[model samples]
Target chain A: MFNTRSMSKLLVVASKDQLDGIVRELYRHHVFHIEDFVETEEEGYEGVKIGMPLPQASAVSTELLRIRAIVSAFGVARSDVVPERKESVSALSARIDAELPQIEAEVSDLVDRRNHLESAIRECETKIAELEPFVPVQVDLSLLRGYEQFSVLAGHIPAKVELPVPAEMYFSGDVSGNLLIAIVPNERLNEAEQFLFEAGFQSMPVPGEEGLAKDRIAWYTQEISRLRAEMEEVDEQVNARKEKHQTFLVACDELLTAEAERAEAPLRFATTDTTFVAEGWVPSENVEALTAALRSVTNGTAYIAEQDFDPVNDNVPIEFDNPDFSKPTEMLMDVYSRPQYTELDPTLLIAIVFPIFFGFILGDVGYGLVLLAMSLGLRRIITGGAGEKLLKVLRNASVSSIIFGVLYSEFLGFALPWEPIGINRHLNIGAEAHGHGPDIVLMLVVSAWAGILHITLGRLIHMRNARRMYKPGKHRNKVVFGQAGWILVMWGILFALWSMFELPLMPSFTGLSPIVAGMNIVTLLGAVMLIVGIVAIGQENSLELLELPTVMSHTLSYARLAAVGISSVAIAMVVNYIAIGMMIEPAMQDLSLMGVIFIIAGIIVFLLGHTLNTALGLLGGGLHSIRLHYVEFFTKFYLGRGKKYDPFGMIRKFTED
Target chain B: MAVETMSVEVAEASARGLVAIGAGLAVGMAGLATAIAQYGIGTAAVGATAENKDIFGLVLVLTVIPETIVIFGLVVALLLLF
Candidate 1:
C-alpha cells in the first residue's frame, strides 16, 4: 500500500473500422494512459510506419476553428449557457459548412455599417479640431485664405503656453492653443517664425475648408451624433444575432473539438491495412472494466491482452493510492515532486507526521478553536482548489493543536481551570525568570528523539532498496554497508546526546551502574557502534569521515521545532498580558463605568491581538513543520525523480460534450 | 538630591541600559543573518513561482525556514531580560 502499484503494459487490437468507437469509449472511461507503440525489427517483430490521422480529422479540426471564431465574434463568454444536444459528425460538419456563410454574411453586414460610421466619426472629429483655431478669432474660413500682403503664419504651439504677441499678429486658437493661425506681414514672417519658435511653436499647414467657423463646428457636431446613433443601431442588430446563436456556437465548438481529438487519436497507434493495435498502461484492477467496455463498444470484435511487466523499465508513471483522510496530503507530494515508481509513496507518512509538527509548534487551545472554526465552519466559502486543500490540512493541524494544547493547559496563553497533563507553563516561566514552557530540556529531548527516529526510518528505507537491487557487476554491497554504517553512527550520537542532557523525557539510566569511569552502558555501547559505522562508511570514501561531525549538527537542527514553538507561546503570553493589563485584571478592582468601557475595549484588543498572533503561528508553524520533513527527513532517503502521467484528454473546462 | 542617592539612581539607569543594549544585539544580529539567508532563497523562489504558480505553496514553506533563526534569537533575548 505504501508502494506504487506495479504496472502491466497492455496491448489492445481492434478492427480499423471499430477503432474510432473503441478509442472514444476508452477516453470517456478515462482509465488508460496511452503510450505510443514502438516497433522492433528483431525476430518476429518488424517495425512499420505508425498510423496517421484519418481523412476526416482535418475537416473536424477546421470546423472546430470556425466554431471558435464564431463564438468569440458573437461575444459568447465561456461561462454562458450551452445546449446539451449531441450531434452526429456528418450532420454537424454539414450544418457548420452550410450555416457558416449565412452567419458570416449576417454578422458582417452589421459590422460593416458600424465600421463605416466609426470612420466617419473620426474624420468629422479631425475637421472639428482644425476649425477650432478660428473659433476665438470669429473669422470666416473664406476670409482667412484671401489674405494678400499679410501672410498668415499658421502653426501649432504648446497647448498650455500663453505668449503676448503684437496686436496685428493675432493668435487664434482655443485654450488648448495647439492650433495657432497667426497672421503677419510677408516681410515680417522671418522675425515672426523666430519669435514663435522661442515661444514653443511647431509650424502646421492650414486647412482649405470653406465656411464660417460656427457653421463648420455645427456641421461636425451634427454629423458625429448622426453616425453614433447609426452605430448604436448596427450594434443592436449584431447583438441580437449573437443572442440567437451563442449557445449553438459554444456547443458546436465542444462537439467538433472532441470529434477532432477522436479522429487524431489513431496516430498514436500502429495499424495494418485492416487492423489497428494500441499500447497503453491501465491499473490492473481496471483491466476488467476496460476490456468489458471495449467489447461492448465493438460488439466483441476487439481483443485486449495484458503484456509482460518490465521490471527494469524506469519509465513507469507513478500514481498515489492512499486512504481518504490522507488524500489531501498528496498536495504536498504534487507541490514538491512525485516519488519514483520504485520509491516509497510518502503520502501516508506525511499525513501522519505533518499535522503533529504543526500542532506542536502552534500548541494553543484558543488558537486551535479559532482555526477549527475557520477551517470547518467556513468550508462552504472555501469551495474548491487551493483554498479547500489548505482548509483540509488545517483541519488536522487544529485537531492536533487542541490535543497538545490540553497537555500544555494553555487556552490562548492563559491557564485554564484544569490541571496540565504535561507542561504547566505558568509555573515554568511565570515564577522563574529563565524558565520557559518550550525552552526547557524536555522539549529539546523530544525534538532530538524525533530527528533521530526520522533519520533512522529514511536509512532503513535506503537499506531495503539497496538489498532489493543487489545485482552482478554492481557495488551494491557498499551501498548497503554505507547506509548501515551511518545508521549506527547516528544512533550512537543520539544516545550520547541523551546521556549528557538531563531532560524530563530522557529514559533514566540510574538503575544501571556506570562503566568505564562515569560513562553509562548505553553511551559507551553507542561510542563503540559509532566507531564501527564510521570505519565501514570510510571504506567507500575517506572524506566521509569529515561528514560524521555534520551528522551531529543535523541532529541539533531539530531544535528549531522547540525554538519555533517556544517563541510562538511567548508571543501568545505577551498578547494576553497586555489585554489583561488593559481589561480584566482591573475590572475586579473597580466597578465604575469607565472600568466597564475599558473592559470592553480590552476585549476587542484581546481578540484582534490573538487573531494576529494566531495567523502568524499558522504561517510559522505550517512552514517550519513541513520544512523539517522536506529538508531534514526526505533528503535522507527519498530522491524523487519521476515523470508525471499526462494522458491525452481535454479537461473541457470552457465547454463540455 | 543627596550625592549617594544620585549615584544609586545613575547606577540603576546604567544597568537597564546594558540590558537593553544586550537584547538589541541579540535580536538585531540574528535578524540580519536571517535577512541574508532569505534574500538568496527568496529570489529563486519568486522566479520559480513566476514560471509555475503550482509550486507557490512549496516555495512559501521553504522561504520561511530561515525565520526560525530570528524567532529563536527573540526567545533568547526575552530570557536574558528575565
Candidate 2:
C-alpha cells in the first residue's frame, strides 16, 4: 500500500438522554477516533460547553483502584499468568460488589502481619551482628553496660593499647585490627578516652540487655527461626488466597477499566443544556456500518452524518494501510514518525530494501546461520510484543544474509567450495587463489550504484507525493521539478563517469568517436543534463545548489556496505589464522599434554573470537544498513510527524461485554 | 655493481613500507575523527534516551551518521593497498 487509510469525519447529534446509548455503540464499533471539543469564541460554539463525566464515573474509578491495589499486592502482573477465559461484565460487577471488600480485608491483614514479622526479624539480626565481635572477648553483656561507678570504652582499635590509668582491660585481635574493652573509675574516664583516641579507636554501642554475648546470640537465632517459620505460614496463606482469587481479580480489573472509560467518555463531547454533539474520524469504509449501529441504538432519534473535510487543512489521524507482511516494518517507520495522512507510506519499500542492505553488509554463512538461530530462539522465548516484532525483522535480515552469503561464496571468511557467484569480498592481491582475488574497485562501484538507485527511487517517491499533496499551482510544480532535478543530476553523474572511465559493470562509451573537440555523445548528453538540472534546482531554491556535493558524498556513503563487510571478513580470517595456523597446527604436530592444552586454548580462542565478531557483525550490519535508509535515502522524501489513530475502545482479554 | 643493485632493492622495499604506513594513517586518522565526533553525539544521545526511550532509534541513527567518515577512510585505504 502506498498511503494511509482514508478517513471520513463524522458528526453525531442527539439529546442528552441518548448520550449513553450512542457512546456505547460507538465504543463497541471501535472504529471512531474521537476529536475532543474545546470551548472557544468560535462561530457555531456559542451555546455549547465541554460535557461532564457521567454520574457513575467516580464509583467506577474507586472500584478500579481497589482492584489494581489487590493485583499489585499479590504481585500479579499481566504477563505472569495467561487469561483462562473471558468473564461477562455482569458477573464481574457482581463479584466486585460482593467479594472485593472481604478479600481486601483478608489480604491487608496478612500483608500487615508479614510486614511486622519482617521488621522484627531485621531487628533481631542487627542485634546479633552487633554483639558478634564481643563474643570472642568472653565477656557478659551486662558487664559492658549499666555501670554506675565505672566508665567503659568498648570498640575496635587500630592496635592494642595499654590504659594510662588503673583499669580492667580485655583485648582480642588479629594482624588486621583489635577489639578492646576497658573499664575504669569515672574519674579516670578522660585518661582512658584520650589513650583510646590516640590509638585510633572507633567506638561501638554497648547492648543494654543482660546476658553473656554467646547466650544472647543463641537466643536471638532461635527467635529468628521461629519468626521465619511464622512468616512462611503467612506467605502460604496469602499464596492460597492468590491462587483462589487471581482470575477474578484480573477480570474485575479489566471490567472496571472498561467501565471507567465508558463513564468518562462524555468529558470529550460538547454539550448544551438539552443536547450533546460528538465529532470524530472514522475509516471511510466503516462510515456506513457506524451510522447503522448508532441509528439502531438511538431508535432513529440520533442524527449521524458524514462531514466534508479537506486533507490539506484537517489534522486527520493516520493509520498505515500496509499489507500484513509489511506490518512489522511499521515499527521502523514509528522510530522516525508516522507518515502524514496524505503522504506516501514507505513501509513496504523498507521491508524489501532494508534487509537487502543488511545482508549485503554481513554476507557470511556462519554468522548468518547463528543470527538466524538466535532470533528464532529468542522469538520463542519472548512473544507478542515489540521485542518479538524486532526479532521477526532480524529473522528476515538473517535469511537475506544467508542468501548473500551463498552469492559471496563465504563461510566465516573461508572460501566456499564454489567460486563466488557475486562480487568476491576476499582480497589476495598477488596470489592466484580463487581464480582472482576480490575486485575492490568493482565492489565500491557496485555499492555506489546501489546508493544511486536507492536515492533515485526516494526522489521519485517524493515527486509523486508532492503531486498528490499539492493542488495544481506554480508552487507545486516547483517542488516536483526540484525532486526531478535531483534525480537527473544523479544519473547524469553516473553517465559522465561511465563515459570518462572504463568502469567495471558499466557500458563503456569512451570508445565512441568524439563529436566535438574531445567530448563523446554520452559525455555531451551528460553535460547538457547536468546544466539543465542545476538550473531547475536553482529555480526552486538557489541555496539548495550548495548541497550539490551531497549527491556525490551520499553515493559514496553506500560504499560502507563493502567496506564494513571486508573488515568483518578480515577479522574472521585473522581469528582463524591465529587459532589454527599459529596454535592448533603446531600443537597437533607435537602431540603431548601441553599440546592438548594448547589445542583446547586454541578452540576457546576460536569460539570467543567468532562470537565477538558475530555480535559486531549484527550491530554494524543493522545500524549501517538502516543508517543508509534513514540518513541518505529517507532524507530525500520522508516528512513524518503524523498523529496516530487511537480509537476509543478496549480489546478485552480477561473479560467480555 | 652488486652493491648498487642491493641498494635499489632496499629503496623499493622502503617505498612499499611507506605506502603501507600511509594507508594505515589514512584509516586510523579518519577513525579518530569519527570517534571525536561521536563522543559528543553519543553522550547527548544517551542523556536524551534516559529522558525518553522511544527516541532511541532516532538517536542511534544520529550517533552513527559521522561513521561514514571512517568508511570513507576505509575506501581510501583499500584503494591504496590493492
Candidate 3:
C-alpha cells in the first residue's frame, strides 16, 4: 500500500503448433500488458513481419458485423440486463447466422409497409389542405379553370382589402371572407395578378381529380386514421421481437468483441515461419503463475524467460495498492497523475486531509445532515452511473462536516440555543459580546495553524524524497538543509507575528526569552534561520532568496479556509435574519392578509436560501479543499509520469467468465 | 481651523473612518490583483487540462494559488480595521 505494485518483464516464446493454447492461457490469467513489437536487426530478434490471425478470423469477423447490424437496429445496451445462461461462442455464432437474416427480413418488411402508409397519409393531407380553401366558394371547381379568353385568379384575400381594379376586370367574393376570384381578359392577367398580389392575396392550388371538397376531406381523415392503426400494430410486433432477443443479442456482441480482440492480438507478436515472441510486463509475484499456466496449456511447447531489470528506466506500468477505505482517494491520482512505480503513492494522505479541509469550510450540522442524506440516497445510482469514488469522498467529507457542525452549534447559521460541545464561532449574543470581525480573525488563526502543520509535513516529505533520490556515493545535499531552514523560518515567523499582533495564542520558544521590546525573541530566531537557509542554498543559486516572500504569502493563503467558512455562514445568517426574523416572526405576532403573504414569502426565502448555501458549500468546499492538498501539500513531494497497467482480458458484461 | 474645533469623540470617530477606508483599500486592491492573476491562470489551466485530463488536479491547484493574495489582503484589512 505504500507504493505501486512491483513489476518485471516476461518473455514468452511459443512454437506455431502451440501458439493458440498459450494465447488462450494468457487471456485467462489477464496479467500481461503486451508491448507492440518493433522489427529490429539485432541477433535472434529479426523477423519477416508480424504474424496474421488464423484463417478462421475472417469468417468470425464477417459474422460479427452482421450481428452488430441487428443489434444496432434493436438498440438495447443496458449492462444490467445480463444473460442468465452461458453458451459457447461457436454455438452462439451459428445460431446468430441461422436466425438473424429471417428476423432482419421480417423487421424490414414491416418498416417498409409503415413507410408506405405514412407517405400515403401525407399525400392525402396535402390534398385536403389545398381543397379546403376553395370550399367557401359555391362555384364548381372545374368552372373556375379551363378558360381560353378569361383567366380566373381564385385565392384567399384580406377581409377588408381594396384593390384598384379597372372597369374591364370582374371580382367575386364569398360570404366566408376567404375565397376571391378575379376574371379579366387574358391580356390583363398580369395586371390583375399583380394587383391581387399587392393586396395580400394567396392563390390556392387546384386539384386535378374531379371531386367535391367535403368528400375529399372525409376521405383524407379516414385514410389517415387507417394508416395510424396499421402503424400501431407494426410497432407492437417490432417491440415484441426486440424484447425477446435483447439478452441473446447482447451476449453475441460480447462474444464477438472478445473473439475479435484475441484474433487481432497476433498483430503485436514478432513471428517467424515456426515460432513467435511475446514481450510484455507482469507483476513480479505473478511471473511464476503465468509461466506454469502457459507451459501446462501448451504441453511444454511454450518457453518463458525473465529479462534483466533496468532501475533507471525500465518503464514498468504502475498499479497502486491501498486499503479499501483509502481506495476512493485513488480517483484523485487519476485527476492528478499516478505516481511512478519507484515513488510513493499519496492516496492515504489525501484520504485523510481532503475531508478535514472540506468539513472545516462547510461546518454546519443542518447542512451536513442534508448532504449526508443526499449522498447516501444517491449511493446506488452513483455506484452504477458515474461511480462510487465521488460518493465515498463526499460521504467522508459530510461526516466530518457533521462532527465540526455539532461542535460549532450551527444549524444552518441559526445559532442553536444550547451550548456547544466545543466552541461555537458565531457566539455573539449580548451588549458586551465580541463582534464578528474578531471572531473571524480567530478562525483565520486556526486556519493558519492548520497551514503550518500541513506545510511542515510537506517539507519533511519533500526532504526525505530528495534524499532518497540522491546518488549513493555523492555528498551533494540539495534538499534536507533547505527544507529544514524553511520550516524553521515559517514556524519562527508565525510566533513572531502572533506576539507582534498581541494575540492571545502564541507558541513559546523552549527555554528562551519570550520578547524583547516590541519584537518577539522568536523573530530574532526566524531572522537567523532565514539568513542561514539562504547561505546554504546560495551555493546553488542565490535567486531563491526572492522566494521567501512568496513562501510567506503561501502560508497566509491557508487563511482562506476560515475566510470561506465565514462568508458561507454570513450568507446563511443573512437569509435566516431576513426570512425568519424580519418576515415570519412579524407575521406570527400579528395576523392579517399582508402578514399571510409575508409568511409565505418567508418560507420560500428560508428554503431557497438554505438550499443555495448548501450547493455553494458542496462546490466551494470540495474544490478548495482539493486545491489545498494539490497546491499547498502535493507540490512539496510528488512528481508523476507513471504508465497505468492494462490487463489483457475484457470484463464480461453479458455472460459468465 | 476645522481640526481645532473638533471634539475628542468626533476626532476618534474620524480616525475609525480613516482606518476603515484603509482596510477597504487593502482588501479591494488585493482582491483585484488576485482576480487578474486568476483570469489568466484559469484560462490556461482549463486549456491545458482539456488536452490531458490527468493534469486536472495540478491545474486546479495552480488556478487557485493566486487566491492567496486576497487572503493576505483580508488579513491586513482585519488588522487595520480592528
Candidate 4:
C-alpha cells in the first residue's frame, strides 16, 4: 500500500552450471534484467553486443546458452582457436549422448517402415482379387472337322500388327468379310487366321489398341506381396537391433539426467550484494552463523542490516490488486477500467450509473429480467482480460435493470404475477390495462436530480485532488463555496420552481419556505465563489474568453437528463403504440391472421427496439459518467499525468502462448 | 441589374446545383483524409521493418492505429446506407 521511489541492484555469483538456476530465481521475484550479452542488438545489424533491453534479453538469451553448451559438449571441434579443450572423459560422455538418440531414432524409423509395408500388403491382396476374373480359360480351335475343312479354303495372309502382350510378340491375321483379326499368341492364332483368309476376307496390319490394365494389376499385386513378405523378415531383424539400441539409450539417459540435475542445483554464492542481503531476513537466533558465513564469502565487504521480527503482511487478494503493467499501452487500458491508484476509480462509478440509465431507457420488466439472467450466465464463460472487464460491466448493467424493473412495477413485461407485499400495482401492461402509467414528467424531474448529484460528485472528486496536491485551505474553501455551492443552488432553484409552479406534494411548496430562502442565499454566495475561481483559472491559462461560455454551457449540460428522459419515454410510447395497434383491426375482430402476425412481429420488434435503446442509453450513460469524472470529478482531486509503475520479468509476445 | 433575367435565374440554379455536388464530395473528402493518414502510417511501418525484421509484430499493431479513421468513416457510410 505504501509507495517507494527507490530502486535496488544486486549481483549474483554462482557455479557455471547453476547459471539457469540464478536466472530463474530472479525471474520469480520480478527482478528485471538490467543488461545481458546478446547477438544482433538491432535487426540486420548482427554483432555480439554487451547488453540488450530486458524484454528482448529474456526472450533470446536462454536458448543461446543451451545451444552453445550443447554444441561445445558434443566435441564438434568448433575451431582450433576455441579455448576449451576436449578431454577424454567429456568426449566419451558427449558420444554416448549423441549416438544413443540416433540409435533410438533408427529403431523408430524401422518400425514405421514395417508399418508402411503392411499397408502395401493389404493393397496387393485387393489387386489379386480383382485379377482372378481376367485369367484366360483353355480352348482348342483344331478339334472341329468343319472348322478344319474351312481352314483349307481360307488362304493365310501375313497380316502384321503390334500386340499388347509385348513388342517382341508377333501377330498374323486374315480377314473375313473385311474383318481383320489377330491374337496375342501368334503360334496359336495362325490356324484360325488361315481359315479366316479362305473365307474371302481382306486384312491389314494395325497396332494393338486393346487395354491390358487388369493384367498389369495382377502382376504388380503378386510382386508387391512377395516384396512385403521380405520386408516382414527385415522388420524382425531391425527389431532385434532396436532392442540392443534401447539398452544403450537407457544408460545415456541416466547420464543426461545426472548432468541436468547438476545443472539445475542452486549455486553457493559468497557475493556480498546477493548473499549478505538475505541476512536481514534470517531469524535472530541464526544471526551469528549467517554473519560468519557471509564474512567468509565476501571478505567482510558486505553491509547487512538487522531488524526486529515485525513481518509485513501483504495478504490482499490478487483480484483486488492493481493489474501489473509492463508497457505504455497498459496505462490507457487502466483508464478504461479505473485509475485504481487514484482516489476515485471511474469504473466503480460507471458500475453504478450505467445500468440504471439503460433500465430507464428500456423501461420493461420482462426484458430486464431476461437480460439480468443472460449477463450472469455470460460472465462465467468470459476468459480474456478485456472480455472479463466487459463481463464485469454487463454484470452491473443487469443489476441496474432489476432495480429499474421494480420502479417500473412490471415484471416480464407484465404486472408481477404474484400479489404485492406493500406497494400497490398501478398498471398491468400485458393486459393492456391503463391506470396512469409512470408520469413521464416526474421521471424527467428525477432524472435531472440524479444528473445534478452525479455532476456534483465529479466536481467534488476534482476538488479533493486539487486539495491533496496543493493548498488544502484554498481547496476546502472551493469545495464548500465552489463545488457544494453549485449543488445547493441547483437544489434551491428546483425547489423554488416546485413552489412557484405549485407542484404535487403532501406538505406542499410552502412547507419548506425557510429552508428554500436560506438555500438561495447560499447559492448566491457559491455562485460568486465559483465565478472567482473560474476567472482565476482563466487568468492562469490566458484564455479568459473560454471562462464564461464554458462555465455557463457546462452547468446547463445537466439539463440533458431531462431531455434524454423525455426522449426515452417518447421512444417507448412509440413502441407501445406499435405493439397495441398490432392487436387491433378496422373490423375489431377477435381472431384474425393479420392480427396474429402483427402481434408476433410487434412483440419481437418492441423487444429489439427497447434493447437497442437501452444499449445506446448505457453507452451514453457510461460516457457521460466518464465525462463527469474527467471534467468534473477527476478535475477536482486527480493529478492524472503521474507516471505509472512497471516491474518487469517476462515479455510475452501476445501471438505466442 | 441584369440585361438577361433568364440568365440570372440560370446562375442561381447553377449555384444551388454546385452546393449539392459539394455535399456528394464530402464522402470522397473523408476518404482522401483516410488514405493520406493510412499512407503515412503504412510507410513508417515499412521503414521500421526495413530497419528491424524482428519488429514486425510491433509494426503491425502500430499500422492498425491509423486504420481506425478509415473504419470510422466506413461506419458512417454503413449508417447512411441503413
Q: Write the per-residue lDDT of candidate 4 for residues B1-82, one digit (tens) a residue.
A: 8675568889988877766555445446656786887788889989988997655544554554443343334323322322
Q: Count the backbone clashes (under 3 Å) in each candidate.
A: 0, 0, 0, 14
Q: Write the per-residue lDDT of candidate 1 for residues A430-535, one digit (tens) a residue.
A: 3223334343456666777887887788888877766654564347778778888999898777667566654467665545567878888877877988898998
lDDT of 2 by residue, B18-78 (tens): 9899899999999999999999999999999999987776787799889989999999998
How do the predictions measure up, each by TM-score? 0.77, 0.93, 0.82, 0.43
Residue A583, model 4: Cα distance from true site in angstroms: 4.7
Off-target runs (Cα >4 Å) in candidate 2 are: A156-180, A184-203, A218-240, A428-435, A515-517, B1-13
For residues A1-657, could you state the per-residue lDDT of candidate 2 as single tens digits? 988999999999999999888888888888899999989999978989999888899998988888898898888776656788888878887888899999999989998999999999999999998878777766667778778999888899987778879999888884236788888999988878988888899888887778788899999999999999999999999899998898888788878887889889999999999999999999999999999989989999998889999996688999989888788888888887788888889989989998999998899988999999999999767887668878888988999999999999888877789888868887552223345567788889889879988999999999988988899999999999998888888888777878889988778898988898798999988888888889888889999999999998899999999898888888887788778877899899989999999999999999999999999999989888888988998889988778889998877788877
Measured by TM-score, the strongest candidate is 2
Q: Over 4 Å off in model 4, which ranges?
A: A1-23, A31-347, A353-363, A411-438, A471-545, A548-552, A555-637, A641-646, A650-657, B1-82
Q: Against the true structure, whose lDDT is highest?
A: 2
Worst 10 residues of 4 chain B by lDDT: B73-82
lDDT of 4: 0.44
Clashing pairs in 1: none
Clashing pairs in 2: none
Q: lDDT tens digits, residues A415-495, model 4?
A: 565543322223323445565544534443454456556666766665554454344575455444454444444454544
Better of 2 and 4 by DockQ: 2
- lDDT tens readout by residue for model 3, A120-190: 88898888888776665555567667879877676777754454654232244543446766666787778
Taking the tens digit of each residue's C-alpha lDDT, what string does model 3 give over B1-82? Answer: 5656888999999999999899889989999999999999999999998998877767777888888788778778866755
Best-first order by DockQ: 2, 3, 1, 4
lDDT of each: 0.75, 0.88, 0.76, 0.44
| lDDT of model 4, residue B14 | 82
